[model samples]
Target: MREEKLSVDIENIVKKWEGKKGSLIMILHDIQNLYGYVPRATSLQLSNYLEVPLARIYEVITFYHFFKLEPPGKHLIQVCMGTACYLKGASDLLHELRDILGVREGTTTKDGLFRLEVVRCLGCCGLAPVVKVDSKVYSKVTKDRVADILSEYEQEAAVK
Candidate 1:
């Protein structure tokens, strides 16, 4: 039933962008926004519906950084790697997070609690060594604070 709904949604999106130039990217963006990641099955369905090849779909998906082949975790941890942040020990914070979460950058935790990523900047240069979890930003982050910050999220999950 869910698959059917997804197919319908994809079809609607395709229809909405049909006959337009540069529609494939737009269609794929809609799919990604809807499902968090593009499922292989959905891409296959899109290939058939749009009369485009599966290889072409995969090419587009892989070419774009915004697209994800796998689903992300509940919380996204973005460590800033800008010059300001890097100079302020952001690398240590990232390493500490990997140790505490047991997941490398671009991968989610086994418990599906966090996904770690490194971004060039978060636009808060004044707050160097910044770490953002979901929508909340932690400034002046330190390696020692990694455990405490994660504990806060773990506690929230437990309460829920």
Candidate 2:
């Protein structure tokens, strides 16, 4: 079953958009912010509330990276593989993360603790070799540091 909190959140968004024409996009954005990904329930609910077709809702959800159909991991690891980062062994870092998480790029680990992604750039060229773990940024990454960096998250997960 889906969490009640998510249902409550969707209800709130629907209420906020009541009688407000052209609020579909805003409501969807708020919904995505509340939940890391846009669950199927939310999409259907939004469609019903906005009088929008499910196809349109699905289109928007798939078009944007911010809206995910599936649940995301606790930690979203984005490795910047831009020209600068690539020159600085960003690919190696990506491989190390995949090895540690046992998931390939653009996929979440089975444990759901981590998702590995390769992005074009994180706009931290000066700090080439950048990676974003959830909202935190790590620069100057090294192959040796991968285990250490991931170990910290593993320890946190253990405590949880």
Candidate 3:
């Protein structure tokens, strides 16, 4: 909910790459890991500090899906739509989530607590229907379990 709070410590992020241009990508990777997304302000600051061109910074950030330009929701829900997952009722699960959250895929709720997305695969073929909430993975997902999963998020939001 606090977009301003989601920022990378510019000094620290750049200091890690001292003396090496090759460390650029690795440094940005760490920055993304810390901020969830790369804010333009942070990118500009990085460019100024690292002596790297702003265009190059923007290029790398845009090329990587992990480096979002905007701050993400408090919780990111990724539903697997891989062949195995789809055949195992992943679409149905997606619908249930949309209905429950009152939002379509690739959107965040008004409260910013949840964001929904359909991914190609989560590399969990064995767990055909897989859903990942933030960093946690839920396997063997079913319609009946959707409410339980969402309720858990609701509770977490309420607590926050």
Against the reference, the lDDT scores of all candidates come to 0.88, 0.82, 0.83
User: Can you rank all candidates by TM-score, best first?
Assistant: 1, 2, 3
Clashes of each: 0, 0, 0
| Best model per TM-score | 1
Candidate that scores best on lDDT: 1
For model 1, how does the per-residue alpha-carbon lDDT over 62-144 read when each residue is reduced to its tens digit? 99889988788888999999999999999999889988888889888888889999999999999898999999999998888
Q: 55-124, model 3: which lDDT tens digit per residue?
A: 9988887787767665678899999999999999999999999999999986778887888989999998
> How many Å off is the CA of 95 in candidate 3?
3.7
In angstroms, how far off is 19's CA in candidate 2?
2.5
Tell me how far the alpha carbon of residue 102 in candidate 1 is from the true structure, in angstroms, after superposition.
Answer: 1.9
* Model 1: worst 10 consecutive residues (lDDT sum): 1-10
Candidate 2 ranges beyond 4 A from true positions: 1-6
Query: Which of the two, 2 or 3, has more TM-score?
Result: 2
On residues 40-119, what C-alpha lDDT tens digit does candidate 2 reach at each position? 88787666656688898887777877676666788888999999999999999988888878888877888888888889
